[model samples]
Target: MACRVLEYLILPLVGAKTLIVGAKSVNYMKKNASTALRVRWSGSIRGGYSSNHGSRFYFTFDRAPCTGPAGIEAVDWTGASRNYHQHIEFEGLCNNIPAGHMQIGFNVGTLPGISWQPYLGWTTSGKPKITAEEVDLGENKGMCPHHTVFNVKQHTLATADTDSGIYGASAFRYTKLAPDTSLRVRWFGALGAKSQSPAPGCLRFYFTFNGEECKSPTPIDGAIAWLTDPIIQTRTTHSSQGDYAVALNVGQCLFGNLNQMDPDPHVNDVSRIIVEEVRLGKSQFAEQAVLLTCSFESSSICGFTQSTNDDFNWTRRSGGTSSSYTGPSSAYSGSYYMYIETSSPRVLGDTAVLYTPNLNLAGGCGRLVFRYHAYGSSLGYLRVKLYNGQHMTQQLWAYSGYSKNTWQETNVYFKQGGNFQIAFEGVRGRGVTGDIAIDAVAVFNVSSSYCNSPNRDLPKAAQQVFNLRHWNWYNLNFTGLGEIKSMIYPKISSTSGLRVSMTATVMTSQRLGPCTQWQFRFGGHVCPVPTHSVEGSRYTYSYQTTTQHLFPITVSGICTGLPAENLVLSIHTSSCGGSPAVDAVTGWQTSFFVSAEEVVLP
Candidate 1:
C-alpha cells in the first residue's frame, strides 16, 4: 500500500573496463587494466519479514555510449529448467555501429524496474535486440503488417487481414510495472468459423498505462478493447485465447496493442504472447478475503446476473448442451460456464437464477468457492441462496442426484451481518437431460477453519520438495531497485540434507510493526532464520482498504554448502523506513517453492 525501492545509475561506460560475473575461472580473471569493473556476488542471502539487514548494492557500467569501447565478456545464467522464471545472459560486443546503437538491459539486481521485462528484437544492423524473457510475452514488434507474419524465427504474430473494417496490428510494450501488478495478455488463435457473425475474427486488445488509456466498458473508438471476454469466436483450431488479466494499481508504463480483427481471412492466427504472473488461491494465506472471483472465462457473464423474475435466463454456455445426455463437454475451469439448457423451450419447475454482486462482509464472515456439473439421467438442482436485499436469507448450497461427471468442488461456510447477494439456483429436472453447469465462482473472507482447511498454508508432506504454484503480486519500490529471481532444480542430487524456506502474506495501509523486508538466497546458502511469525490475526476487508498481515516468514538451513545446478532463488527487499512499503500482496494465494526432506532410511 505504500512503496519505495529505487536506485538508478545510467552507467555511461567509457575507457578502462573488464568484467566477468558468475565465475568461469580465467584464473579468476583481471587483466585489462584501466580500472572500472569488479562485480562479485557470493551467497547467503537470508532475511525475510523486514528489518532492513545489511543492504548494499553498487555496480556501475557504461563505456560505449554508442559505437566504441564496451567491455563485459561473460555473465551467464539461463532458463535453468525454467518454470516460474529465470535467465540473466549477456556476452557483450560493440564498436561496429553499422547502425545498431545497443540497449540490452534485461535487469534484476534489485527487481522492480517493471520486474524484469525484455523482449525486443532487431539487428539488421540497427541494434536493440533481446529475446528470451517470459511468463508470456512482453516487447517485440518492429514491423508486421503486409498482411501479417512477424515470425523472426518463431516469436509469432500472424495475420491474413480479410477485410471488414480493416485491422492487423500486433504491437506490444510492457515496462516498469509495480503497484498492484497483474497484466497478463496471452494468445493462441482461431476463428475461421464455428461462430462468427457480426463478431468473431477478433483478438482486439488495447491498453496503455500511466498516461491513462483503456476505457473499455466496450469501446472501439475511444479504445479500451478487451480486458476480458474475447474468445475469438469459440475455436476454429489452435486454442488458448487467454486475455482476462487486468488488475493494476498503475505504477507506470504498460502498452499492449494486439489487434487481429480479420473478417474471414481463411483460418485466422494469433500464435503466442504470454505475460503471466497470475494468482488465485491455494496458499498466500489461503486466498484472503476475496469478495468475488468468477471463472466464467469471459465473453461476458462473469458478473453473474439474471432475474426479471427468472423463467428462462441463465445460459452463458460453451461446448455442450444442445441435447445429448445433458450438459458440459468442457468448462469447469475456463472457456465458459453457467448453464440451464433443459432442451425445448424448457419445462418442469423451470427456474434459472444466478446473481452475485453486493458482497460486503467486512466482518460478517465468508467463504464460497464453487464448481459444479451434473451428468445425465435427467438431473436438476443446484441451489445456493442468500439475498438480504429483500428476501431469501440463507440456503447456502443444495445439490441433488448425479453429482459426478467430473467438476464438483464446493465449500460454502457463511455468516452475514450486513450486505449480501449470491443466488445461483437452477432447478429443472425431468426430460432432455436437464443440463446444469457452474464454474470457479470464488468468494473468500477466511476462517471456518480457514475455509475448510486447504493445506492451511502448505509445506509439510514431510518437508516437501516441489510445490510450484506461484501468483506474484507487487508493490515495493524504494525509489527503484527491485528483485524477484526464481529457479529451483531440487530433484536432489546433493544439497546434502536440504532445507530452504520463505513465507509471506502481507498488506498494509499502516500497522508497520516489522514493515516487509526479505532477503533469501538458496543454492548458494545463507538461508537461516529458523522461524518467524506475526500471524496474530488482522484481516478486515470489503475490497481492500489494506491490513492483512501474515508474515509466516521461516527460513531453515543445512543447505550443506549448496549448489545443485544453478538452483538460485534470490528474493531481496528493502524499506521499513516507517509507513508505506508493505504490500507484497503475497503473490496471490502463495507458493514460491524449493524445499526438501525425503531422506529417511531405517
Candidate 2:
C-alpha cells in the first residue's frame, strides 16, 4: 500500500500564531484552545491495479491549488507541506506466486512552490524470508523552478505496430510575462536505419496555450521536413544516430501550457528537450503579409515601367507570338503576358529591362514569386535583379536554355532594409527565333521557408508509382441494341488518410464513346470528371472499340488520416440519336482496370 500528499493549503496567520475570525480568534499550542483555524484541501487520492500487468498496483495524484477559506489576514506564506501514510495486506497479493524474492519501486514529485524532504520508512509484520530495502531520510532541498528541462530517451514505433506514434503529453508552469513573447522550443531526434521509401519518417510538434492548440507558423505544417509519407512496411532491429531539428510555438502564456509530439510512425527515437529559449524582444522573422500583386492581364502594366536606358521595350501580347516556334502557344493562366520580340530593329545580344515601382522593404525580408515561359530552340536568358538605394544592385535569380518548353515558376528571397525596386532583364539569343516572357509577379513580407515551399494551391499531378499500392479490375458487360444500363461499384479499402489518386483503363468491344457518362465519389467529395465538360453532374465522353482509353482521376479529402469511405464509381450509357448499338446479335464485353498512387498529405 502507498499514500501521497495530493494537495496543500497556505496558513495565513494574523499574529504570531493566531488566526482571527469575525468575532472569534484561535491561538495554537494552547492547552484547552478549541480548533478554529482550518486549511482547505481538495483533489483525488486513489489506487488501482494495472489492467495489463497483474503484479503491479499504482496510485495517481494531481496537484491542486492552496487557498484560505475566509476571515484571515494576508500572510507572507512562501510554501506549504503535507504528509500521509498507508498500510498494505501483502498476504493476499502473493497467494499464487512461488516462493521467491520481489522488488518494489516508487516515483515522487514536488509541487511548484513547495520543497519536500521525504523520509520513507516501512515496517513488516514478521521478518521472514522476504526482505525490503532500507529507506533514507535526507535533508530538505529546494526544488527546480517551473521551467524544468526534461532529459529523456523515448522511442516510437511504425504504424505497422500501432495507428499513430504519439509519445505522450506533459505540461509546465510558466513565469508570467508580457504578451506576444515568443517561447521557442528546440528538439533533436533520429530515424531508423531501414527507412527506404520515398517518404521518410520525422517528428511532429504541437502545443496548447490560452485554451487552444497552436503550431509553428514558419514550417507551414508542424511536421518536421515534410513527414508527409506514412506508409512503412518493413523494419530493422537497430537504429543509427542522426540529428533532426524541430520547433514549436507557444503564442502567449498565462500560467502554464501543455505540449506533446505526434511523431510519424517510422520515427525511431527522440533524444531530449535540448533547448527551450524564450525571446522577450521583437523578432526579425515575424508573421507574413502580401505586399504587391500583379497578373499582367490588363491594359496597364501594374505600376511597371520600361527602362529608357535599355535597348528595347517589352510588348504585351495575347496568345502566341507572330514568329513561329519561338514563344509560348498561350498565356500561362490568363490572356496576356509581357514579352519581347526579336524580329525588328532588335539584333542579337539586345537587352530589354522592365522596372517595378519603388517599394519600401525596411521592415524585413520579402519573397518575390513569378512565372516565366522560355520555349523555342534559341531561348534567351532571363535575369531577376534587386535594385536598392542609389547604387546597390544584386542579381537574385537567373535562368537560361530551353526548359521543357513549358511555363515554370520560381521565387527569390531578398532583404534590402531600405527603399528598393525589382528589375526583369532579358537578353536576346543567337537569332530572332527567341522569345522570353514573364507573368504573375507578386511580392510578400514573409520568411525564406515560404519561398522554398512548393505552390500548395496548384493540383498535384496524378502518379502511378508509390508505396502501398492498391488496384483491382472491374467489368461492365452489355447485350442487345439500344440498351440503356447503369452500374454502381464501390471500390475502396482502408488507406489510412494518405493522399490518393486513381487512374483507370477501359477496354471495349464496340465504340460507345459519345454515349457513356461516368463519375467517382469519395464520401461526400466528388472527383472531377475527365471529360471536356465540367459543368454537368456526370460528364459524357467518346471511345474507340478494340482500343484502350486512359482516364486520370484525382480524389480529394482523403488526407489528414481520414479513411476513404463509401468510394463509388458510377457509369451509364444513353442512346445516341440514330446511332448503332453495340453488337445487338451477340453480347459485347467491356473490361475496366483501376490503379492508384498514395502519399502523405502536405
Error of 1 at 393 (Å): 12
- Candidate 1 lDDT score at position 128: 18
lDDT of 1 by residue, 466-564 (tens): 112222222222221246555544322121223333333223223333233444555434433222110111111112123232221222222332322
For TM-score, the strongest prediction is: 2
Off by over 4 Å in 1: 1-288, 291-319, 323-329, 332-336, 347-351, 355-360, 363-386, 389-419, 424-438, 444-602
Per-residue C-alpha lDDT of model 2 across residues 1-602, encoded as one tens digit per residue: 00000111112122111111121211222111111111111111111111111011111111211121111111111111111111111100111111222222122233233333321111111110111111111111121111111111111211122223222322333332222223333222221112213432233233333323433322111222211121111100111122222222212112123122233323222122212222221122322455566667678778988988889999898889988878777776457888888776778789999988788764557767777888777767888998875454789999888656677777567766667888999998877778898877776565443334365221111111122223322223334333222222222212222323221211111344322222223343333322111111111122323322211111111222222222333322233322343432111111122222233221
Q: lDDT per model, in order?
A: 0.37, 0.35
lDDT of 1: 0.37
Determine the backbone clash count of candidate 2.
3
Candidate 2, TM-score vs. the true structure? 0.33
